[model samples]
Target: MELALSLGDTPKPFSLLDHHSGSQQQKMKDLGFCMGLGSTRNLEDLHIKNMMREKDDEKVISCSSSSDPSSSPPPLPLQLDLLPFSPVLKSPPPPPPPSLSHRPFPWLSKNLIVESGSQSKLVKVIDAKPLTTVSDGEELAAGEYSSPNNSNSGTSSFQMDFSSIFNGGRSFNSRKRDLELSVNLELVDATERDHRACSRGGGGMSDEDENGLTRKKLRLTKEQSAFLEDSFKEHNTLNPKQKQALAKQLNLRPRQVEVWFQNRRARTKLKQTEVDCEYLKRCCETLTEENRRLQKELQELRALKTNQPYYMQMPATTLTMCPSCERVATTTTSTTTTSPCQQAPPTGSHGL
Candidate 1:
């Protein structure tokens, strides 16, 4: 027989075993059951105390068995060391609420009629006239205002307040408009300064001596020059955005950046032309030397032909006749005095 005990508000039924033949064992089991009830309340208190202490401790469940079943049960004084089992209690932390900032605006995603509640509308600032007091019907006809928080109806019957539409907060659009206006003012100022400089002959000196005009030269910093060189190496051309970005980075006007790029490209083309001219000069020199060598070889060949021996130029035959026999003979003065045809026959013997 066995008994299970728990230290909670509700007491669960104990698992019963088969009937035991021994009366002493049965009596012992009954006594254990009765003793469990008395210690239940005390166990509950000890469990509460352990829970407070173990709040920050590692999560674990410890269990033990009695060494001697025949021995009597321990006293009702609750001691953790004597306990056989312990149940761990844990409470999970609550989940956080979903954030609206990270959520995508459904109207913008689907290209639907944009509601005022859309966060994208809060960030996007377009130049437009401010809303004026108008009838609800006219406002609905304009189709410029709609609130997601109010009604799903296409037309609103109430006069929509600007403050309420902007959620009672300062509209980012106003600040954005002010920033754009400041940038435009800066651009205008820069243009006016450029015009004044041009009028004062700041670019270059006049050709006529009567008008003594001199240009103002802009010297770029070494760092700025190096950055521009690197950018040029990456790409020789610049779009408007790149020009603007470079101008902002170098603290120069956009026109200045554009002019610098133009001058740099011209310099590159001029250097390439000089290099090509030098290459052509070298090629001309090499061709001249080769032509001179070929002409000298041709002249040597002509001299050899003119200085050839007279005997080498003559024909091999020199006709002669034997005096005693009156026989015709042919001989070459360069080889032998007597012809082979004449020597083969007797000197006095002749066909005549």
Candidate 2:
């Protein structure tokens, strides 16, 4: 007879070969009973086969259960092998930025003109008058002796006497003695008047006035001041030759030019110091503001940490146990719904 089996309520014809051997026919019968054929002996054999299949499946499950999913071995590391002749790509370095020179004093920007010929003429003028070494008493006496002689002098004789006194050819003692011997009453009175005049009119005073106790302050002319300012702008410091040239140009002593340059340098330094101080003050203010802002942000973060909910901060995993097998399992969930492992077991043959 040709046997037909239904799978899921659909009937299909099942057939064995017409020339099948007994052992092969018996094997087909066994397979048919396992697919729900109603035969007592064949059903017993099918039951035994089902039991063996169940045991094998249980063994496979036990092996899988022995190793934990959480304890799975890390994935194999990916090896990167470099190929020969393969070009390596690299980013080129950025070009350097343009450099700027530092200028501390911005106001000193003018160029100075140094005239070589003018400087030479100044040196010649300074060399012409050697500073007098004669004492004040001798100078006074010499002046008195020359007073009467200068009145009559359209002559070579007067020029000779004047030269003899001033040219340093005669000794101071000889000049003083000659003045006292020829000193008339009128001349003595005239000397006293001249002494009074010298005291009253400080201008055009002799070298004795320069050597006196009082310090003389020389005022520079506006043109001289302007020239010095231009020179100072070109170079803060002066060489000896430059100093002498400037002094001659300004009709000032070399000492005066040296003092002016020293003062100018000091003023420039003071101005630079003030600028630096202002810059530092602004930087300090900016840092202080940044610090205050950071402190406020830190306080807000700390407050947020204190006020956050405890449940919101908990980890995503919860311990769970299977209802049918009572096996322990770890579950990761976002919601409060019970997982499949914690659900009630089904009724009837579906319990496994």
Candidate 3:
């Protein structure tokens, strides 16, 4: 709005226009305009605006223009669309990246700027550097870029080299994870079997390990058992120190050695007792057979002696009759035998 002073000689033009409004400055920046101060006349003209008074009317005071019409500034363009010159005047902006915390992986680039000589510059700013990984894979953030005239149309490109800091980590981590999972699976399987056994019979696990392969008892190798057997042959018993030494040599536990010695001693004693019992039984049977043969021979001798008659005796022997018995009696002969009256029945009355 223009205001004119009613001086007695001539009228002067004054204005209450703001030189740089917020919207005007924003539009100027969008158009890639350089912001600078104006001339002294323009500054004086800007400060000449009078503040409104309570009784002043809100109406324009008309005044005539200056002598130079060509010096006046042209009006601002009313219709300015960024469509036709969009490709040349303004370059497409670099896509806005997420914050470090929200990103899937760490990206340590601080700021990415793609600048073109003929077109507008595209800028993408990152707030903070990304965090380091657990393995201490510290990414090296560099801002080494060059704008070549011919290449990329004078655009600046950034390059990064994720060198040996993350080297050998992938294979090591994968193998370690596999081993841990295997151990965990074994433990889990054993636990599950124990739970099942307990649930079925209302009892805890036994020495058989619930028939699980992971719970089977350890068996000594052939070499280990052979060494153990030789040691046992040397001495059937073992002291604590000796057992420890043997166990260390065999790569086994002292308890296992001690148990083996105990079992070996028991088995040896059992075998010896069995041998002695078998020998005694055979000897008893032999003696019984010998006694039976001797008894049979004695019975045959007694029968032969009783059946011999007085006439079958030698000529030197005599026969006589006693007054108490009517039967004939034989005298002592060269052979020793029982008398007919002993171990024999009496003769019939007709024969006497």
Candidate 4:
């Protein structure tokens, strides 16, 4: 369970707008050192209180003018009266102090890199002042920022300038791409081989001894390999007993198995997301091409339909000559006359 509370109960930034001097004249700025990103409701409460005080003052002024001087009761004492105020001499008021706890720059992440493996493998940003460092010279190493108790990396609490991590000719983006390619390739290859091996039945020894006992060579430490192989075989969430059994088989602690499962789930999800994204991309391209082709076809059809030639009346048929009688046929009955070859039936036919 992740808790949102910070160590030191620092009062969140409370903006005291001097309504007396100017309302919009003063710029609002964040105040106070961040224990984390921004202070909690404690800071919000103070802001509300200040706003109420200003509203009360405004109400007092408005009510006072409308009241009868003779019968109206004395003005109520204001909460602002109890608060101390220093009189400014002749100097211009100091620039509105920047809010130390203003909503952190929107683009910046509130998380500190607790453990940046090939990817940001394990991240915990519980503190308010989320482990930011000044300038670009102090980027923390891969193992320098987790809890001190972590067995893998002993010293885990180091302040580092995150910007420096992206510096030195090679950018974080490039490094991230390289890391992604490496992890992705490793995971894909492992998964594919494991799938292929498992689908081919148990990838163990084939031959048997004289006693009919088959000797199998171990590919990994008994426990470690079993844990991995079992993970590939099984589906659904593992219970404590199953986890322990798996851990024992793989020669690892239960915690290591749990973490491995967690990381594996994350990696699989990421890969799936990438695949889904690629599929969507291809789908979009196909749709776009189809749309373009349809549009072209529609345009061509439209042009063909719109640019059709106007209909013209056909001329009356007039035969210029007759083949059988060798005379011009003035009327349009050219089919009524025929040559001897056309009029004669075949020799086998009986035509009188």
The Cα local distance difference test for each model comes to 0.35, 0.34, 0.34, 0.30
Please name the candidate that would achieve the greatest lDDT relative to the true structure. 1
lDDT preference between candidates 3 and 4, better one: 3
Q: Model 2 clash pairs? A: none
Top candidate when judged by TM-score against the true structure: 2
For residues 188-225, write the lDDT of model 2, one tens digit per residue: 34334433434443211133344565543434433346
Instruction: Please provide the root mean square deviation of candidate 2 (C-alpha atoms, Å).
Output: 42.5
- Please give the distance, in angstroms, between residue 159's alpha carbon in candidate 4 and its true position after superposition: 46
Clashes found in each candidate (C-alpha, N, C closer than 3 A): 0, 0, 0, 16
Give each prediction's root-mean-square deviation over alpha carbons.
49.4, 42.5, 62.9, 36.4
Give candidate 1's whole-model lDDT: 0.35
Give residue 50's error in model 3 in angstroms.
Answer: 99
lDDT agreement of model 4 with the native: 0.30
Residue-wise C-alpha lDDT for candidate 1, range 99-172, written one tens digit per residue: 21122211111112234654222221221222212234323222233223435223332221222111222222
Per-prediction TM-score, please? 0.29, 0.32, 0.28, 0.26
True-structure lDDT of candidate 3: 0.34
